[model samples]
Target: MDAERGGGEAPAAPRDGEGRFRRRAFLVGGGLGVLGLGGAALVAGPGGVRSAYTRVVCGSTPEPPPGGTAGRRQGTLEGRRVIVAMPRAARDTVPVVVMLPEPPGDARAPYDLYAVDRYLAASPGGFAIASVDGWPSADIVGALLPHLEAGGLDVRRIGLLGWAAGGAEALRLAAQLGSGVVRAVAATSPDVTAARAPLRELVDIPVWLGCGERDDRAPQTETMLKGLKALGATTEGGISSGCQDTAYRRRVLPEQLAFFARHL
Candidate 1:
């Protein structure tokens, strides 16, 4: 996969361990508060919705921290179910990242469990990462935001990530929310046309556009990337592997999270 920095032209590869260091920084200092000894607790909400509040500790994982309890809490936003992961420390306000999953099926599943856990554990400052079973609806996310804020998430530092149709929703929401709140966005194989126009409105937001090399929508992703660059938005990441493929997410998500760490 080819990853490029913002602007119309591509820059040379990062020298030495710069790229690696950035990734490590994302895992270490990515959150809103400095890491410290803390615990996580699940704050149970109504109807089986889960939410978590944690006191973050230093390093990549949260278990090493002493004193704070760790767990997930269930909660609902406008009737939509969500899964949230809180960091180990909760003393300070923290940023929150929302990952919009693919549409639901017969069985309900946790959203981005693997990625969310990894991010929260590695975050230097605690971050509350949440996700729903379906697309990233503005109404749903908007509702979720308050609940998370009330639980200690810093609404000011927020990020959005989505897959496929969910990806389009992230872009649309970023445009609607504007730079005031949304700091970064990552959309994989997004149906670019579904995003509302005034697409130029996203010029100020840093977007990580990901698509599979074999995806039919690759052209759309390319088109959107070109348009974003032309409009002056900082666009990073180009394509991964697979065509509208889920396997490619593993390759793309870390980069997206790192982008969010850089901006949010």
Candidate 2:
């Protein structure tokens, strides 16, 4: 099956090395703090650690509510459960952001974990959000794009967003689909090591890679950023002061959305 045609079997779930890293980072940093080892002092003592940590862990701003104007649709595609969120006052044909959830998370993860619907409502431009169950294969997204277009989305302008393992999948799919098909890609706490595509393939595509400063994957994310730059790929995002947790993702999501809005 050709990935470009979106007619291939889904790949097995990629191994999750980041899960171990998330656990370790939590235990070592948040755990020590919880154990009365000056966690409060570190957070309250303030040398900007508190501010940065709070921003990363507890987002500096409040997430918006999904206004009545927004619409949500759910169904199955290629045997995978799918969920799509359409922004407020969306046009008959809107661009879309394909969300690839972390391994073990289903189509609902984007909303349940990130409140993506609310973010979409708050975005300056209108776009739809499409998420699928399990690890996303190029075939799954490849099928998804046209499906969305059939449902009134602008398939020509597309973006991919994912977290952790899903992040890697997003990168792989973007490369496989080629720059002509994908406009931009954004990832949080991605396991780039798991992505099988060559960075050179991403030369013309705009990419955004972000992770928590305290996340164990930070170094790898930085390395990926440098590599993308070396390839002259337009890239954004770097280490922020938080660990590999939900808070960090929420804090970074707006920027990711903005990046997509600019390019897509």
Candidate 3:
């Protein structure tokens, strides 16, 4: 489970915070006993993924896409029933984050936010933090298309933050959404070469890609700069510091939030 990128001679887990993050990333949610609340799903078309995103686990249970578990509605993606959590608080045109989890059965769950939230727990400039679940990274965002618009969200300020599956999901949406999503951040995200043909579509928006040097799953640090370059995106790529684990050096998530705040 929390191995090095590319699955080579991975190093041992450090006793520092990063090590804890990796361990948490892979198995946090697995240990939890989740209670199904009859989720609400919104299905979309046939989506694609390059290399899958890193699998990290959070202690969160699967719920509907609106960000809460109270009243569940039914949605579909590719005709598959989808469930989303209803947003907890009342928001008027709130900036939202669309997150996709790694494959459900994959070693890594979609809990990358457990680590991301540690750094970005509070919203910047009163921006409310919200994430929607999808069949994959792409499916989670399908709800945002029109099915869930009544939430009164400000689409102009929507920022996408995806880990492995979610990153690809966000990228897919970026290819289609045009300027709908103001800013994007991909953490240990896949490259365009592995994405669909639309990967070349230009975003012209501010995007950031981050990966650990040891995270071989995708471009550890520099691949995103190259990929976004082709897409004509105003983009930057770099390694994240402050990671306690040497195998998967971490990019400071706060920097990611700063990028979102600055651009979105």
Estimated TM-score for each candidate: 0.65, 0.73, 0.52
Worst 10-residue lDDT window, candidate 2: 41-50
TM-score-better candidate, 2 vs 3: 2
lDDT string, candidate 1, 21-138, tens digits: 5564444333321322111221122111111111121112212223433346667655666667677776677788777766651002323333455544554535666775444333
Q: Which candidate is the best by TM-score?
A: 2
Query: Measured by C-alpha RMSD in angstroms, how accurate is candidate 1?
Result: 20.0
lDDT, candidate 2, 1-264, per-residue tens: 455577776666546886665464455456446544435535444444445455545455445554633468988876877788998787567888898878875888888777888887788767788987765444565576777778888878789888998888888888888788789988888876624445888888899999887788888888888988987889999888777777778878888888988998
TM-score of decoy 1? 0.65
Model 1 weakest lDDT span, ten residues long: 46-55
Per lDDT, the best of the predicted structures is: 2
lDDT of 3: 0.46
Candidate numbers sorted by TM-score from highest down: 2, 1, 3
Candidate 1 error regions (>4 Å): 1-71, 105-115, 123-126, 133-138, 194-198
